[model samples]
Target: MLRRNVRLRREYLYRKSLEGKERLLYEKKRKIRQALEEGKPIPTELRNEEKALRSEIDLEDDQTAVPKSSIDDEYANASERDPKILLSTSRNPSSRLTQFVKELKFVFPNAQRINRGGQVISEIVEACRSHEFTDIVMVHEHRGEPDGLIVCHLPFGPTAYFGLHNVVTRHDIKDKKAVGTMSEAYPHLILHNFSTKLGERTSNILKYLFPVPKPDSKRIITFANQSDYISFRHHVYEKPGGPKSIELKEVGPRFELRLYQIKLGTLDQTEVQNEWVIRPYMNTTKKQKILGA
Candidate 1:
């Protein structure tokens, strides 16, 4: 098993590394094909390889017309099965943090929360992998307040770290009447203002956490991006009078997440490269949005 895993990892890395070259070749073929269709001369930069590109284009079918991306490999089989998530807290979590994790368990369907007593990060990751969990979410607290969250995809990872702020748990909601009952139904997702490339990447990281919901599912979860901060909201809507008269109720435990770092490897790996990291001190324009256009 270990040998097979190492070989598979090597193959995956090799394919990922070749994406740039494959993309360049695809562009060359596209340019040559376009020039031929328009009866125009091929661009000077691609003239040398026009013959080869034209031949490849002729052999291309519908599936080969567009080059595949490495991102597709990361979650190629994601839709085939629902996500199984393992939720855990930092060691010796406070009561408040424990409550927050309990609330999170309901927030994500098919999630199981486990005690972090004496278990290290590596051990937790290994156990989740062995159990075929799709993702592992670890919440950290500062002074008894949940302040950080880590999401690591199983087997291989593109782990994302977010700083949690303004967390309001279900029990913390002052008005008990307004809080909607937590539903176990799969919730529909609404991803708003994730416009840029990085924003799209971040959105995918959050999107695959939930399985596909049915069309009739009234429960909705929204991840709205504003000024690079993602506001997480959960709600269940109803048609009290009719389709024309709709009512929406906010479920408790809303929070804001600011992405800080994305690592190419899982939580247990220390030497892997970081896909992206926020650099707050870098000199740039004051009004810049990393997660939105």
Candidate 2:
């Protein structure tokens, strides 16, 4: 099993490294095809390769016309299988953090929470990987308040680290009447204002955490991006009269997530390159948005 895993990882990395060349070739083919269709001379730079590109284009069909990115491989089979998530907290977590983790367990449909105990991150990651867990979510707290969240995708990862803020768990909600009952059904997702490339990448990381919801599922989970802070909300709706008379209820445990970094490797890998990271002190406009336009 170990040998097979290593070989597979090597193959995956090689394929990813070739994506740039594949994209370039795809552009060349596109340019030649466009010039031919418009009855114009081929672009000067592409003229020498026109014959080869044209022949390749002739052999291509609808599916081969577009190039696929390496990013797509990360969650290629995500839709085919229900996401199995492992939720845990930092070692010797506080009572408040424990309760927050419990609330999170119910938030994700197939998630299972385990006591962190004295286990290290590497051990936890290996155990989850062996168990075929799709993703791992670890929450950290500072002075009994949940302040950090790490989401690591298994087998291969693009782990995302977020700083938690304004966390309001279900137990903390004093107004009992306003809180909606937690539903175990898979919730439909609403991702709003994720317009930029980084925004879309971040959106994909969060979106695959939940399995595909049934069309009629009343539970709704939303991740809305504004000024780079992602606001997470949970809710359930009811149509007492009809579709026109729909009523919405807010579920507790809402929070804001500010992404700090995204690593191309899993949580346990210390030497991996960072896919993206926030550098707040760098020279830039104060109003610049990283997650949206």
Candidate 3:
């Protein structure tokens, strides 16, 4: 009876040890597969263990760890979140493509770089619509590298000249009506990059292309009403010797036009005067309101 008891205990211990070993092997396999699919280097010990396991276990049965399936899942999730950039290898399919993709991933951590089909442009358009990206930045290299183009064939419209940088310009209700058509909004000037000199030239170009509105008395009144009040002294002298030399004559309640100075496109002298006449109207209104009979 003593011998039989010892034998049963030993068998039970042996079975428990085997079960523990199988559990360890399964865990190691899972970790190694995860690292591989993520393009991470596996550790030496783990790699060796994986090799041995491959010889013993049928890899075909481990369909849960397929790299392609993992990539597809990642892409689907990324597409649902942000703009998707599909990199086309057709333009230049080289090993460098991998590094380029990695660089793009680094720049836009949320973006995914997928191998594109022949319909790359359409894919880009769809991505823009789904993701609602304001603008597209494309890296172009004529030396057989991939070039990202504005997908929808939509024009980039006129850029505002800020003297130091080109900014996007928007059309107002009046401006849109004056334009009369979408074709008129197409970019008349192309700037390769943002530069100070380019901005000056762009300003000049915009001024040349668009008709500048002349500012009148009504415009001045409207402009003044929208701005902070500023009082400036003006001489109301009749002539050189017509009346006693007027000194410190108050003439205006001009708006602080300097504060509201806009640099887009160009402005004429009349516009500038209209922009500055707020203070005079303000002064007159104050005089009437306070010193009325």
Candidate 4:
């Protein structure tokens, strides 16, 4: 039954890929057909382009078409699926994922470090079922620092990959009071002075982290910003003015996190098909190394 489910998912991915390719071809053909009806000269290059796209799609289909035997073998070869993860960096020496994973274990003891080697996304995500991993933190390499972060939750997820800089942990924080709050209080997310595109990516991350509660639930989620830094303060407060809302006097766990990294965007695909944002895209503004670096 597990194998059947995995097979279905792979089929869905292939169909989605094909759809993207088909949409591009359809747009091109529609433009060409419109030109013909209007008696405009269609460029020969476009004709060549259409042919090339068709050929490419056909080639991709042939190359990626999964066999039933391979599907079974994938599950069979899966080493182990457990919430205890095998964290490691890509083979790049500059990668900090290995180091990050080391530090992370203290905070999230569920993770286990594996030697850095060649591991792709398909195997990791697939292993989620076969190996039973609850999460995968894949950090990709960049020139100065390993800035790409791919956080995949299993058996399914809000799998997010994004570029971040100035990443640090609680140990790095001098003010222990910085650890904010995680109470019965609905989470409030804020984004400060993020560029338009970056803001969208951060917003997506916030949504994933603090999804909306059920309609009837009174879980409070707030969004308030203070210039450059995001502040999340959770407390139940009452409105004597109109409604009968009151503040929850009983406080909860405090969680204060400091993230200096400017969110670039969703970590995009790199040479490693499963790895995201190993290479940055152009046009968007990028951060320079911090003053000390």
TM-score ranking from best candidate downward = 2, 1, 4, 3
Candidate 2: which pairs clash? Answer: none
Q: Which segments of model 4 are wrong by more than 4 Å?
A: 29-150, 153-158, 161-202, 209-211, 214-235, 240-293
For model 3 the local lDDT of residue 94 reads 52
**Whose TM-score is greatest here?**
2
- Candidate 3 lDDT, 1-293, residue by residue in tens: 34653575466446544655656767777777678789998867776577786655555465543323211221233223323333333344454434444443432223445554454543554454345442232323334443322111111111121111111112212233222221211111222222333233322322232222233211111111111221111112123454465332212211121111222211111221121112345446443221112
- Residue 213's C-alpha lDDT in candidate 1? 94
Q: List the residue pairs that clash in candidate 1.
A: none
* Backbone clashes, each candidate: 0, 0, 9, 21
lDDT of 2 at 258: 92
Error of 2 at 243 (Å): 4.1
Q: Once model 2 is optimally superposed onto the true structure by TM-score, how far is the C-alpha of residue 280 displaced, in angstroms?
A: 2.2
Worst ten in a row by lDDT for model 2: 279-288
> Alpha-carbon error at 100 in model 2, in Å?
0.2
| Runs of candidate 2 exceeding 4 Å displacement | 43-48, 178-181, 281-287
In candidate 3, which residue pairs clash?
252-280, 253-278, 253-279, 253-280, 254-278, 254-279, 254-280, 255-278, 255-279
Per-residue lDDT, model 4, residue 281, is 41
The local lDDT score (0 to 100) that residue 250 gets in candidate 4 is 16
Each model's Cα RMSD: 2.2, 2.0, 30.7, 11.7
lDDT of residue 88 for candidate 4: 53
Give the whole-model CA lDDT for all candidates, comma-separated.
0.88, 0.89, 0.32, 0.44
Q: What shift in Å separates residue 97 of candidate 1 from its native position after superposition?
A: 0.6
Candidate 3 segments whose C-alpha is farther than 4 A from its true place: 1-92, 135-293
lDDT comparing candidate 2 with the true structure: 0.89
